[model samples]
Every structure is written in structure tokens, then in C-alpha cells.
Target: MSFLTLLDYASVLVFAASGAMVASRAQLDIVGFAFIACLTAVGGGTVRDLLLDRHPVFWVADPMPIVLAALMAVLVFFTAHLVESRLRWVVWLDSFALAIAVPAGTGAAIELGHGPVIVVLMGMATGAFGGLMRDVVCNEVPLVLKQGEPYVSCAMIGAMSAITLVWMELPLNIALLVCAAVTWASRASALLWGWSLPVYKSRPPRQ
Candidate 1:
């Protein structure tokens, strides 16, 4: 398979894993796992396609992605028992998904004529939002929403850097590699070192 195709498949698997992890946490059924997996795998791309006026969206154009996501969800659902730790699985799977998705989303947005600013936003959303939705649906605060890590911010930086490199005529492969590396590093650092952006809360009225 071509590199792009490989990236797509990797994204699907990772996203499916993210969703399935959340479903397991929620104690959801198999069907619920599949639903979350499919949404997490394709939701961002679906939104991107719609915004870009790209017809048929991605999963609609190929049934294979959905099938793969569902199958993977099933595997995760069944294997959840054998796994000794849930948090480890969720974090690693989410990290993997973010690494694949930021580049893919940025590339797609650039291809669709979006500028650097928009591409970065799209990339960040693509990397983080589906899982955010899954968390919200499960009645938990989304990771990206917390003041704990630089998740979406990392995605934005990587996407913008990639888009800038592309604008300067860099090859797609090189851009993808560089951006993916930076994104992964930033996110992993946040997770491992407890790095976070500063929160600037307004002081309460003098009491």
C-alpha cells in the first residue's frame, strides 16, 4: 500500500482503539463500542470533507475504513479483559491516534485550499475532537478541555509547521515526518512530564 494509504489505516486503527478504550471505561456494550469507534475514526474527516465541499466524505467513499474500525473495536472489546491496565492502553492509543491524525488533517486541509491558520485548527480538531466527544458523551471532562496538557496546542503547532513547509515547497513526505515528530514529542512531553499551558484566570473581586 502507498504511504498515504498506510497512514489512513493507521489512523483508523488508533482512533478505533481510542474509542474502544473509552467505551470500556464506560462499561458499554459491543454495539456501543462499535459506535464510538466508528465516530472517533471518521467524525473529523467527515466534518473536514463537508467543509471542503468534498463529495461523499471519506468513510462513505470506502467501506473498508468503517469495517476495519468496527472489527478493531470488537477486538478491543473482547481483549479488554486480558489487559491488566486500562489507563495505559487509553493513553498510548490516544497518543498514536493524535500522531497520525494531525498530519493527515493538515494535508487534507491544505489540499482543499485552506490556509495555514485554518489548516492548523482543522488538524488540531481532527486529532482531538472525536475523543473529546466520546469523553463528553461518557459524562467526563475531555482531556483537551482540562488545564493538564498541551494536546490540541501541540496538534495546532505541528499542523501549522507542516502547512508552512508545504507552502515553501517542501516534499509532502518530509513535511509529514517533521510535523508528526514535533506533534508526538509535544504531546508525549505533556503526558510524561505534566507539562501544561499556563491558565490565566481572572482574580476574584477583592473580598
Candidate 2:
């Protein structure tokens, strides 16, 4: 069990839980919960793998991630109503998933000898795409598309931070850990304190 594989599994589990919460909010059936959960778990990595031409998508190759996702879906389906705010749970879980999955994507790109740009792009894709898909399917606003939030930026910066650490000749494992920490911290700040980039304000035409 390589560390990267473990990252994938962790992200899949967390993202699946988040997806199931969204399904619960939508009042979807158990099957719908599983469907949304599995989609949110693997959609991003599936995109990353396909774009990178990595033979055999991660979930397709091992299927443990899918199984894990389905199990998480079942758990969340039964317990979601216990939460007073499923939306908050979904956000926090998705943030954790973003942190884990971004590092996994960066590591994959780095291992493949891809340049920094590809690393950053893959990281963002892997961290955000699943949630985007889940939200779109569930008719919720996509977090990545939310105004001013640093969602995609968090992934990008996290990947670049990993690259910087690697360039300093640090251990790859340490770099990945830093990546996860940076990504999660960025997201947490946004969620907790409303940290965000400046958005252009629309104004009436001046005379």
C-alpha cells in the first residue's frame, strides 16, 4: 500500500461522505445516495487519470475506493438526519477531501515527471472536480464556482508548495504532507472566517 494509494482512499472516503450528505439534503433514496457518493468519490481522480493517460483509473484498478465509498454512503444515509446541519458537514468533509486528493494528484504528476504547471492543474482537478460534479448533479451551487472563495486556489497553491519543497530536495513524503496541510488550512480559513479573493463589484455607469 503506497502512500499515494492511501491518499486516494482517504479522499474517496471523505468525499463520499460529503456526497451522501448532499443526497440526504436532497431527500434522495439510498440508491441515489450511493450513486452520488461514488461519483463524488472517484470523479476527480478518474478525470486526472484519463487526462494523464495513466492506464487503468485508480478506482477501476483497485475498486477498493469504490467499495469504501459505497460503504460510506450507506453509513451517511442512515445517520445524516442526526446532524443539525448537513451542509456544514458536507463542506468540512469536502475540504478534508480536497486536502488529501490534491496531494495525491500532485504526487502522481511529480512521479510522472510532469512539469509544475501540469502538477498544479492536476491537483486542482483532482481536489475540486468530484465536488463540482456532485453539486451539479444535486442542483446545488458548485463550491469551486462560488464567488470569491479560494477553493481552486487552495489546490493550486498547495501543489506549488509541494513543488517548492521538492525543489529544496526535501523528502517526497514530507512534501506531500505539507501539501495536504496547506490545502486544508487554506480551506478552513475560508470556511471559518470568510477569507476570499476580491471580486469585481458591478456598478452603474458613471457620467
Per-residue lDDT tens digits for candidate 2, residues 1-207, read: 999999999999999999999999999999999999999999999999999999889887889999999999999988887899888898899999999999999999999999889988999999989999999999999988889989999999899999999999999899999999999999999999999999878775852
Supply the TM-score for candidate 1. 0.92
Which ten-residue region of model 1 has the weakest summed lDDT?
1-10
Q: Pick the candidate with the highest lDDT.
A: 2
Residue clash pairs of candidate 2 = none
lDDT of 2: 0.94
Off by over 4 Å in 2: none
Q: Tell me the deviation in Å of residue 122 in model 2.
A: 0.5
**Over the full model, what C-alpha lDDT does candidate 1 score relative to the true structure?**
0.82
Local accuracy of candidate 1 as per-residue lDDT tens digits, 58-130 = 7787778899999999999999889888867887788878888888778777777777788888788778876
